[model samples]
Each structure stands twice: as structure tokens, then as C-alpha cells.
Target: MRTAYSVETVRGAERELMGRLPEGALMQRAAAGLAVACGELLGRVYGSRVVLLVGSGDNGGDALYAGARLARRGAGVVAVLLSPERAHQGGLAALRAAGGRVSDDALRDIGRADLVVDGIVGIGGRGGLRPEAAQLARAAWESARVVAVDLPSGVDADSGEVHGDAVRADATVTFGAYKPGLLIDPARERAGALRLVDIGLTLPEDAEMEALQHADVADLLPRPVPESDKYRRGVVGVVAGSARYPGAAVLAVAGALRGGAGAVRYVGPAAEAVLAHFPETLVHPGPPDKAGRVQAWVIGPGIGEEADALEEVLAAEVPVLVDADGLRFLSPQRTRERTAETLLTPHAGEAAALLGRGREEVEAARLASVRELAAQYGATVLLKGSTTLVAEADGPVRVNPTGTSWLATAGSGDVLSGVTGSLLAAGLPARDAGSVGAYLHGLAARRAAGPAGAPILASEVAAHLDAAWRDVTD
Candidate 1:
């Protein structure tokens, strides 16, 4: 798994490591790694024109030290000091001793440079870049290949929020470990490719955020034992679709049938369509309560304002997954009163409605939004996007890394909801169910898209679940 720690945790770890080392050992280690990465990017370091955007913090010092290393190697290194008076004296002196020069014309130097290193702001910075820095950032982006030191300037390192103007780098070379923002969206979008430099600072096992790898998913997935029967394996009940949208039922059932669940019992108005497509499904044209025994329930894909079905499903004694129209009538009060485990799968627009905010607000601060929704509703939440996030009231947020952009098609959420509900029925906890389901769903989407990748249908993604499952287990 690829893990990320919170800023507070990272700081604590850094302090502990720094205390054990000599006065400037940690900075030198970081500078050496940074110089190596910069050298690799510029294949011929000698005679290469490198520009450094120097800030007042240690981040600027890192850039200055790295520039000095390159200058000693015959590179034309110039530091454009954002705060000359406050620049690291040790770093500044090292640059001068290495024959590197300080320049006031940042824009001009940036335009003519082979590469530009962004150190204008560090993890401690809260807001966007200042006017002078912002202009230099923009110019650097257009003129040369920009490499962000640690993280890009002007992005929230902990939350991945980019409020105003920010540096858009060609690549980011992080130190010791990756910050949460490096893996999340908005800020993640600005961070092109990512490289981690290990400075040997040991962190805790429990990170603020995590991305599941293939082996991790395999370990979490439920497998059938010799004594396991159809009923013992688990049964998933799906309450979805309407007369107007029978295809939603077909798609949802397709996903559930391939999940770890031994059987899929579908209850909805689209029973005829579901039976026609998946003859193995046990279909019932009635309410969720009268549908008979089920280990877990998945409600509202295309049920379109059907509050009665949603309420009945919510009141079930087992775990429940609510999606699409099922989220329309939901309230914090209603969700809090439920006795069973509940999971909410919401896209940005639906999440906005639930939070009483705008869609952009939810999309911009996805980590904050998911955590808030989980806390407010008192349930597990799976926020769908380019980077799918699963959050609960407590514990680290799980980020899915297996998704393809081609997964953005109609009925995709319906498939995810069914797959997650099936996992819940198979006896996984709500949090585990949501996280594991997202991992497989994204992997299936990638496999379905194929090597060259084509615009795939949601049904194609469902069909490829078995392949994804095998790849994980194998």
C-alpha cells in the first residue's frame, strides 16, 4: 500500500529524526537526494541552466543547497530569492562558494532556463501564492520544465485543497514520505508525476490516508471454504431500478452476481428486465422487507424518489448501501437513528445536496467533505471521483489507486454500490466493505478499458470483475 501521513505526524517524525542526527545532516541528505533527482531530469547537468525560486523557509534552503551541488557540476545555477533578507544564510553562502549567482530578474531567468525548481512555499504555507510569486510560477510553468521541491507551492499539504493560484509542476520530488495532498485530487492534478526520496525517517503504521495495493486487496477478499454452502457464503439483496430505467437493475445485478456473494436476490419494479439478463438472480416484485432473507441490502440506483423502498431498506437488520435517488430524502437524523451499519456512496453533486452546499465546494475539498459527511451522517462514506475515497467517523481514509478515467460512464455508481453491498453481506465491516469494493471496481474498470484503452460501457466494467478478482488473488 502507498500511505501518506498527516502534517502533524510528519513534523513529529522529522523532529525525532533531526534530534538524532547532527545539526544539518537531515538537510544535507534531502539536498543530496534533490540534486540527484534534478540531475536525472536534466540528463546533462553540466552547462544546464537551472533556476530556483527561493522562499524564506527550509524548502528554499533545500533548493539553494541543491542548486549549489549542480553549480559545482558546471551547471549555470541562479537562485531567484522571493525573500532575500530572510533566505537561509548557510544555503546562500554555499551557493556563492559553489560559483552560483543570485538574480533579481526571476521572470527573465525562468524564461531562459532549462528547468525551474519551485520552493516558493512549503507544507506550512496556508494560502495561495503572493502576486510576485504567482506571476513567476505562471511564467515558469509556460517557459520551462518545473520540478516542485517536496510539494507544489500554494496547495494545502494536508487536505489537498487548492483555493487560489498555485504552482503547476511537471513533477514533484517529495522528501522522506508523501503528504496526503500528493495523492489526492485538485492538488494532485497540479502535481504531475511524483517521486519519493527516502531520508530514513520512520513513521507510524497508521497513516492519515492509504491507497490499497493488489496483495492487500487479495488478503481482504473473502474466499469460499470446503464447508461453505450457498447460504453460508452470503446473499446480497438489491433494491434498485424502476419501470422507466430497467437498465439500472441489470447493471447492479451484474456487479453483485460476480462479487463474493453466493447469491443475488433482486427486488424492484425492473424484475422482468433483471430476470431476462441474469436468469440466476432470484427476483421479487415487492418491498425490501417482504423480499425474504438477505445478508445485506443495496437500495436506490434508479428508483427515482422512491422514499418508501429506501425507508424499508434502511430499517433492515443488516448492513445497507444507499446510492443515487436513495440519497435524495436522507437526513442526518434519519441516518443516525438506524440500528444497522449504513454506507453512503455519493458523487460530488449528490454529496453537495446531502451537505447543503454546492457541488464545487464538495469537489474542491474532497477529503474534508468525505470526513464531514461520514461524521454528520454517522456512517461510512465512499466519495466517487478520479480518486475514490472511503471514509468513516474514525481511522485513516482509504484512497483507491486502480481507477481509469474511462470508468466515468453511465451506471458506474450503481455497479459500485452493488459490489460494496455484497461485500458487507459477506461479513466484512462497513469500512472494509466500502474500501475493498472500490479497489476491485476500479481495477475491473482498468482491465475492461484494455491495454490501448477504449471508451468502455459500465456493463463492460461489471463483466471484467472476475478478471480483476483473479489478478488480485493470483
Candidate 2:
């Protein structure tokens, strides 16, 4: 797991480690790692022209020290001090000793630099870059491949919120643990490729937010056994679609077929439509209670305003996935009363409805909104949009890394609901089901799009599920 701790946690860890090590040791370690990274980017340290955007904190100290290291190795380095007086005194002295110069030349020699190091701010920064820093960052971005110290300056270290003016780095070299801002958007979007440098700081136990790695994903995947029969794998009951929108039912069933579920039981008025598209599906035009036994249930999707259908699914004892129309009819009281594992998959609009907030509000702060929804409803919440976020009722939030903008098409969410429902039926926990399902769904959409860039249909996405699963499993 790739863990992301808050900015406060990182500072606490830094303080703890700083107390144990000799004075300036931690800063040296940070500078050494940063220098090595700069060297790698430069290809050859000798004769390379490097510019450092110096700010008024330890971040500037890191850049100045690293610049000194590069200067000693024959590189020509210059530091642009935004705040000359407040700049790290020790670092400035070291750089000067190593032949690094501070220049007041504005755009004259900046565009000619080979690399630019952004040391404007670190985790301690709250808002966007100060006026002077922002101007320097803009110039650096236009000229060189910018590398950030700690994080891209001006991005909220805790929330990933980009305030006022921020530096968009080509790559961010972070110290200690990954910040939540590095993994989430809009700060995440500004942060290009992220590189974490271990500074020998031990994080706290409360640091729980994380991103799933390939190995962790592999371990959570469900596999079939030789002795396992169809029933043994698990049965999924899908209550989706209506006379008005039967296509959702077909798409939902299609997604469930690839979920490693033993059997899929469809209970809705759109059975004929579902059977027409997927003959393998066992459809029933009866209520959810009459759909026979099932390990898990998928509700909503294209379901119309039918209180009867919603109530029947709610009464079930198995794990339930509520999506689309189900989200429309959801009440705080009903959600609070849910006994079994409940997973709520809501797009920005639906999430807005559930939270009684505007869609823009939900999208702007997706991490907080998802976590709030989970806590409010006492269920696993998956808020889908540009960057999908899944949050459990009591655990750290997860951000999906494998998604494309093309997934904004209609009916895509329906397939996800079914796929996650099938995973739940197959015995994966709610959090795992939501995150893994999102990863698989995004990969499948990418594959289905292929080289021609064809518009991916819901069924095409479902068809590519096996290939997506293989790519992850292998």
C-alpha cells in the first residue's frame, strides 16, 4: 500500500526524527537525495545551468543545500531569493562557499537554465505562491522542466486544494510520507509525477489514507478454486431498470457476468430486455424477495420512482450496492437503519443530492465529501467523477488512479454498480469491492477504446473485463 499521511502528521514525524539525528543531518539527507534526483535529470552535473527559486522556509534551505552540492560538482547554479533576509542562513552560506551565486536578473538568464528547482514552499504552506514566487514559478515552467521540493509550491499539503497561485511541477520530490494532496486532485492534477524520498521519519498509527499498489490489488482479487461449484462462488441479485429504461438492466447484468460470481439473479420489470441482450442471465419479473437466495444485491441504476422496489431491496439482509435512481430515493433515516454492508455509488450529481449540497461543492472537495457521505450514511461511499474516490465509514479514503475522461459517458456507472455488486457477492469486503471495481472498470474502458479511439459502449466495457482482470492478475 502507498500510504498518504496529512501534513501535520508529516511535520510531527519530522520533529521526532530531527530530535534523534545530529543537527542538520535530516536536512543533509534531504539535500543529498534531492541533489541525486537533480543529477539524474541533468544527465551530467558538469557544466549544467541550474536555477533555484528560493523562498522563506526550510524548503528554500533544501534547495540551497542541494544547489551547493551541484556547484561543487562543476555545475553552474544560481539562486533567485524571493525573500533574501528570511532565506535559510546556513544553506545560503554553504551555497556561496561552493561557488553558487545569487542574481537579481529577472527573465534575462532564466530561460537558458537547464533545470529549475521550486523551493517556494513545503508542507507548511497554506495558500498559493506569494506574488514574487508565483511570477518566478511561471517563468520557470515556461523555460525548464521544474522539480518541486517537498511538494509543488502553493498546493494545500493536507487537502490538495490549489489556492490563488501555485507552481505546476513536472515532477515533485516529496520527503517522508506521501501527502494526501499528492494523490488527490486539483492539487494532484498540478503535481506531475510524484517521487517520495524517505527521510527516516516514522509515521503515526493514525495515518491511514492510502493508495492501492499492484500487489495489494492482486491479494484482494477473487479467484476460483477447483472444488468450487457455481453456487459456492456466490450469487448476486440485481434489482435495476424499469419499463422506461431497460438498457440499464442489460448493462448491469453484463457487468455482473464478468465479476467471478457463480450466478446472477435479475429481479425487475426489465427482465425481457435483459434476457434479450444476455440470454445467460436468469431473469425474474418479480420482487427482490422472490428472486431466490443471493449473497449480495445491486439496486437502483435505471429504476424509476418506485418506492416498492426500493423498499424490497432495503429489507434484504445481504450486502447491497445502491446506485443511480436508488440514490434519488435514499433517505437519511433509511440509510442509518441499514444493518448489512451497504455500498453507495453516486456520481457528483447523486452525491450532491444525498448530501443536500451543490454538485460543484461535491466535485471541488471530493475527498471530504465522500468521507462525509460515508460517515453520514454509515456505508462505503464511492463518489464518481474525473477522479473517483472511495471512502469507508471509518477508514482512510482511496483515490482511483486508473481512469480516463472518456468514462464520462452514460450507462458507464451502471456497469460499475453491477461489477462491484458481483465482487461483493464473491465475498470481497465493501471497501475492496468499490476500489477494485473502479480500477477494473477504468482499465476495461481503456482497452475497449483501443487504438482507434472508438467511443466505448457499456457492453464493450463489460466484454473487456476479462482482459482487464488478466492484466491486473498477471
Cα distance off (Å), candidate 1, residue 218: 1.2
**Candidate number of the best TM-score:** 1
On the 0 to 100 scale, the lDDT of residue 403 in model 1 is 82
TM-score of 2: 0.95
TM-score of each prediction: 0.96, 0.95
> Residue 252 of model 1: what lDDT?
91
Cα error, residue 374 of model 2, in Å, equals: 0.9
- Per-residue lDDT of model 2, residues 219-267, tens digit only: 9888889999888899999998988999999889989988878889999
lDDT for 395 in candidate 1 is 92
lDDT for 297 (candidate 1): 94
